[model samples]
Target: MPGRVFLTTPVAEIAARFGLDPEPVANEPPRQNISPGQTVVALTPEGLQHMRWGMIPVGRVNARGRPVMETIVNARSETVFDKSAFAGTGRAVLPVDGWYEWTGERRRKIAWRIRSAEPGLLFFAAITDTWTAPGGQVVPQIATVTCEPNADVRPVHHRMAVIIKAEDVPIWLNGSEERAAQLMNPWPDGRLVVEAATGVDWSDT
Candidate 1:
């Protein structure tokens, strides 16, 4: 699962990079433990926007007729479109400065940070959808897509976000299912560098 990402870029930079119009932009909040149901930055046809991290399907109702709050924060790229919840909405970008993962003795997990090798920001593959409340209120949501681990990520975690190259961003964002799936492989081994830490804590920095 892709969890615990950090976005350090200012909103203006993100807007400029994606050619998005001005909108509400905020830096990372104080949530050291951001789990499902939280909101995160995700791109959509509407432009670079913020949406709930979990993906709640439209028209899905519980026995109480209330919309279910989806707890899914990550979706596998290989089967996203094949799944009913994300059939037509299986392509998007989740920009981040880096991500945090745990690694160490099984008994005691230590945290580490993995960032993009390039100078700018990193965009991870994502799927987005909209949900309507019983009162006719609409809410948008997104889930990051993951694939097998690449070299730099294998030692840290078994899965990594599906990162699309700039040249293929358009194709991944708005291309055929078959074509987009083809780009969801682990990043090349040396594309990223990892630095071990005493523990997984970014609060000091």
Candidate 2:
């Protein structure tokens, strides 16, 4: 699960890498400790935009008719297609510099930072949704897709984010759900660098 992520590269660099336009925004500074509920940059069919990290299913309401805020941060890639919440929704790619995971006993757990061996971004496959509230408010949200861990990530965790190669972005975003699901496999071993996360601060990266 990619609960924590960091994006230290400049916005312009990210746009250039993906051949996208860097539209003017209030700020797009480097973030080293982005958590759920925080705004993160994503590449969508409509272009690059910032979306909430968690998803709230549409039409979910409480007994009192109030909007139920269900924050789903990660979706299992294996069953995403059959799941009603994600069956036909549009797909997205989250450009992350790296992700964080923990290991060891609960009392003495250690944090590790995982990044790509090669330079540039690691695009995480994700699903998006537009939720509506009773008050006529609409919110766009997203959840990262996860799959069984490969050799590189198994020691740290049982699951890892479903990463898509840059060249496959077009298919992942525009292809049919069946075709997109085909790309939801574990990232190959030896292509990732996992190391002890020591003295790493969100603002320092």
Candidate 3:
């Protein structure tokens, strides 16, 4: 499964396509090192906004009142509705220009980038939770919803994000979790293009 993604789409374009007012934040900044815990833009009822990449539930704080663990960054799409982590009102969209995957022999890891076959953004379905801290402070967290790999990605990874097409965005965002689950299967062939890496070391930290 992909752990890092890149979004090169201009912020204004992303916001316009998703129907959100663009923030003053500088136009789409290329994200080459989108690791977990990094802030990323996500879609919500309040419109598109930025949120922490990892998901931390409300009461999971530790002794010093900090978050208890590394955020739950990705949720398997098939199990999201059933898991306590993303049940109920959980829903979101993790838009990306594409994502990076690592593959190689034995211990070597090579990185490859996957993007849409055409010029547009891809929306990875996700779920978010808003939790209130012990001090009554609230914070938002999210996890990317994942699905079984499509033919193109099966060799590189066993899981892939549940990509929501433009037409399905409303259903995914507004329908019941069960309805959203119904859309979690691997997309049809040709929906994505895999760019193989020729000679790149993806194992470097």
Best candidate (score: TM-score): 2
lDDT of 3 by residue, 74-161 (tens): 8776566654444453678888888888888867777778878888999888888775667997767678888888888887788888
Which has the greatest lDDT?
Answer: 2
Q: Each candidate's TM vs. the true structure?
A: 0.81, 0.88, 0.82
Candidate 2 worst ten-residue window by lDDT? 59-68
Better of 1 and 2 by lDDT: 2
Write model 2 residue lDDT over 48-160, tens digit each, in one string. Answer: 88888888766644446666567789989988877655655678999999999999888898999999999878999999988676798777788999999999999999999
Off by over 4 Å in 2: 24-26, 58-70, 133-136, 202-205
How many pairs of residues collide in model 2? 0
Candidates in descending lDDT order: 2, 3, 1
Query: Cα lDDT for residue 36, model 3?
Result: 78
Across 26-138, the per-residue lDDT of candidate 1 in tens digits comes to: 45343334445777777665666778887765554444567645666888877776755455565678777777788878878777778777676778888877778789988
lDDT of 2 at 179: 83
What C-alpha lDDT does candidate 2 achieve relative to the native structure? Answer: 0.85
Error of 1 at 151 (Å): 0.9
Give the runs in model 3 whose Cα sits over 4 Å from its true position.
Answer: 24-28, 58-70, 105-107, 131-137, 197-205
* Candidate 1 regions with alpha-carbon error over 4 angstroms: 24-35, 57-70, 105-107, 197-205
